[model samples]
Each structure stands twice: as structure tokens, then as C-alpha cells.
Target: MAISDGETWVLASHNAGKIKELRDILAPRGIALKSAVELDLPEPEETEPTFEGNAALKARAACEATGLTCLADDSGLSVDALDGAPGIYSARWAGEPRDFGRAMQRVHDELGEAADRTARFVSVIALARPDGSISRYRGEVAGTIIWPPRGKGGFGYDPVFCPAGERRTFGEMAPEEKRQLSHRARALAAMIAAEFGS
Candidate 1:
């Protein structure tokens, strides 16, 4: 396994919720993990044009900064009606202090009954060694948007997106339940199978 049991690695993210989700998946594999914020590491700007590129950018920056093996993910909601908008700008809509409520409202307003509420959450994860090259994995969850956010569990657009064939939005699902059906989870699972072989 490239990154296996008993190994401590850096998770290049500042979001506590994201870190918690990572632990929920990685901890059972006997991997000890740490986040960039936990280590007080600088977060690299996501300047890349695509999810894979952005993930690689962050992973490389974290690995170079701390000399630790790092893993990073870049994910966003892409609405078909919006022409795949709010893709890279997903985080930007959160504003300086990160208010997702406002972001959600903006999406609703922008969407305005376009008939096609089809959307998908896409995640690209990159694992980088101290030397900075990386292996990448991608995952996506297709769903449709529902007006007025639902239960409050996940961050971002979770409250309004209902996965295909499911009535509950991600925000309505428990953490473990979300893990079972999440873009991030799929990405992590793929990463494990690709690099760790388990």
C-alpha cells in the first residue's frame, strides 16, 4: 500500500467537517491523519481550472510545506441548468466568512425554475508525496435540486440536492449515511483501492 496502516499523513484541508468525514472513512483503515489547520500549515490558493488540477495544487503545496505525505480534494456542485456554473466558484459564493446560507439562496435565485434541475457533485482527490507528484482519483454523485434546503447535516449545497432515485437530501442523511453515498466517500474509496489496494 502506498499509504497504509499505522502511517500518519497530512489532509490538506481547513474545514473541520471535512476532516471529520475523512476520519470516519480513514480511521477504520488504521491510518492516523492530520489536517493542514491542525498542523498550522498554509492553505494553497486553488488557482487551477479543474478539480484534479486544484487538488494536485493543494496536495503539492501541503507536502512541500511540511515534508509530509498529503492528500487533498477539490469538489463542487455543478448544475446542468446553469451550464455547470458555480463549479470552481462554489467556495467563492460562501464569501469571506463562509456563509453557505447565502450561497444556497444565490443558487436558488439563479436557477429560477429552469425545468432542468439536474446536477452533480464532483470530487477530485490527489495524494502527494513530499516530492510533490501525485496520483489522482475522481468521483461524482448525480442528483437534482429541490427548492428550500432540507435537513441540516452537510455543508454547501447538501440541503437542497436530492440524489437520483432518493427523496432525502444529503443534509437529511446521517453522517454515516452520507458517507455511504457521498462524492467525497467515493473519491476516498477509489483512492484507497488505487493506491492502497484495499
Candidate 2:
């Protein structure tokens, strides 16, 4: 799909951090963006079993509801030791109130042996048109979990997982720096190249 200047795209998510990230990534191409929150879009049910399923659900819902091009992303931290768990349920891992600290602690507890601490952040992005046509992209970054939670910059599992070749966790890096190396960013880059041609 060719993206033309002035074309508006809806990002099917209400998270401010995600909205900001999408805006930053797509703004340079002259695409206008609107978030789900801004459009008062309903939260679509993520009953799907995989990231691809969840992403497509949101993208389809947003496109059908607004009659606009839409993009949706579903991402999570999957630990090798946890049997790829906390996959679709990452957001609910901490229960009601969404305490990421608690969720991280749970992960640490589940993987008692530090040798089993290896993990990766995975992201899947789906883009859909009002007519139901869709395209998907995926990306991941390998890392290991730290016990004490090292940084203060990012949200969720950022404070504990340190990406390969980096001493500091993502939470220690500036948002822009993190964006350059994050799984979501990598997926978005691929989507852009695939849809728009480098």
C-alpha cells in the first residue's frame, strides 16, 4: 500500500506511550495520525490466542468503525523459561490495577534459576483497510531479566530486561534511543519498508 502525504491513519490503541511512538515514527512520512482515544473508539476484545490475532482484531475493528486505514500492535515479554507465557496475558499478569512491578516479580519467582532468566520482547503489528485487506509484521529483541529493576525511563518490563550488547536496561535509555532498538520499532520499520518501499 502506498502512503501519500496528508493521508490519515488511525492507531488502534489508547496507550499514550504507543500513540506517541507511532506518531513519532510515521510523522516524518507526512501521514496524519489519530489515536483510538482521540476518536473515542471502543476497546476491541483481544480474545485471540496470539499477537497476530489480537493485532488483526483491533485493526479490523478500527477500520470498520471509522472507515479509515488503521494499525494495531500487540506486544509482550515472553520468557523462555515460562513456556512463552505472559504472552497474550502480559497486561493482566499483575491482575486488576496493572502493577508491572508485581508482574516482573512473578516472572522472577517463576524462573527461580537465574540461568532461566533469558527472555525476549516480541511485537506484532497489523495494518488493515476498511475493506478487510490486511498486512502483518513482527519483530523481537532478546534480553535477560535482572532482579532489582534497574532504570526509571520506560514502563512495564523495561526496568528489568536488558537488551543484548547493552549494559543498561531499556528503562535507562531515553525514549528516542529505546525506539531505535525496540521490538515495536523494528516491526514498524519493516512495515514501512514493506508497505511503502524503502
Candidate 3:
């Protein structure tokens, strides 16, 4: 199915940062996003083993609940040095309140001066329709974890992720800049291109 201009889609996420980021990305296309949190939909447990699985699960849940077209994003950082320790568990590592500062510290401590700081951020976008059809797209960006986290922009592990070939971290980059290179943005672009064309 294709999304036309002015179509409304439910974003199956409660994170304010994610909602804002998605809104910014879709606004130019005249697509309006209503987040699940705004609709008072319950957050489903992410029991899926992979990003694609979790994204589809959440999108399907939201579509079933609201009977509307829904989108879900399951994204996280995977550090090569740690053998992708925080891949799916990135959010859990932060605990209930979602203190990313502590999570960043844990990464630093766990790394413990390892020479290899290579990491990559992965994003899977799942779109579910009321007709019970679901489609998924995946994007990834390689980067290295930096010490002493920089910048105040973006969220989650952005402060510590410096995408390959860039000296600045994701948090240090402007929204427009990040959008140009981020995994989430890439995934969204791929999905839109496939479904909506150009």
C-alpha cells in the first residue's frame, strides 16, 4: 500500500525524541504522525529477538488497536568491542527512568580502554496496515564510540556515536545533518521510496 500526501499514520512509540524526529522527517512530505502515546495506546513488550521483529510486532499491535496505518521503529546501538552487548537491550541498560548518561558510562566502563571502539546504529521501520499487511525496512550506520560524550542534541546513545568519516558525534550534529546520515532516516527513506515512490 502507498501513503498519499496528508495521510495520518500512528507512530507506535512513546519516546518524545522519536516522535519529534519522525515528525520533522515526515512533515515535509505532508504526512502527519500521531504517536501511540498521544492516542493512549499501551506500549507492548519488545520480546522479539531482532530489530525487524520488534518493529513489526509494535506496528501490528498499534494497527490492531487503532485500526489505522501504524509505524514502529526499533533502533539501537551495537558496539563491536562489546560484541554487540547492548544491541536489543540498549533501552533496558538505561533502567526504568531511561537515564542514558548511566548507560553511556556503562559502555565506557565495559570497554575499559579497548582499542576498538567501532559501533553501528541500527534502525528497523515497520509499517502495518489495517488489512493486516506489514512491511519492514532496515538501515545501519557504522561509527565509533567516543569517550566523555559530546553535544546535547539527539537522544539515547547519540552523544557517544560518531558516524564513520565524521569527527563529530551524532549528538553534536544538527537535526538536518543527522537526518541526512542517520540509520532511522535511511530506513524511513527506503520505506518511503519503496511504498510511495520517489
For model 2, how does the per-residue alpha-carbon lDDT over 3-115 read when each residue is reduced to its tens digit?
66778999999777778888998998888999999999999889999999999999999999999999999999999889997888888897778788999898888888758
Ranking by lDDT: 3, 2, 1
Cα lDDT of candidate 2 equals: 0.90
lDDT score, candidate 3: 0.94
C-alpha lDDT (0 to 100) for residue 86 of candidate 2: 87
Question: Which should have the higher TM-score, number 2 or number 3?
Answer: 3
Question: Best candidate, lDDT-wise?
Answer: 3
| Residue 135 displacement (Å), model 2 | 0.4
Model 1 C-alpha lDDT per residue in residues 115-147, reported as the tens digit of each score: 999999999999999765689999999999898
Off by over 4 Å in 3: none
The lowest-lDDT stretch of 10 consecutive residues in candidate 1 is 1-10
Tell me how far candidate 2 lies from the true structure as C-alpha RMSD in angstroms. Answer: 1.2
Which residue runs of candidate 2 sit more than 4 Å off their true CA positions?
none
Give the best candidate by TM-score.
3
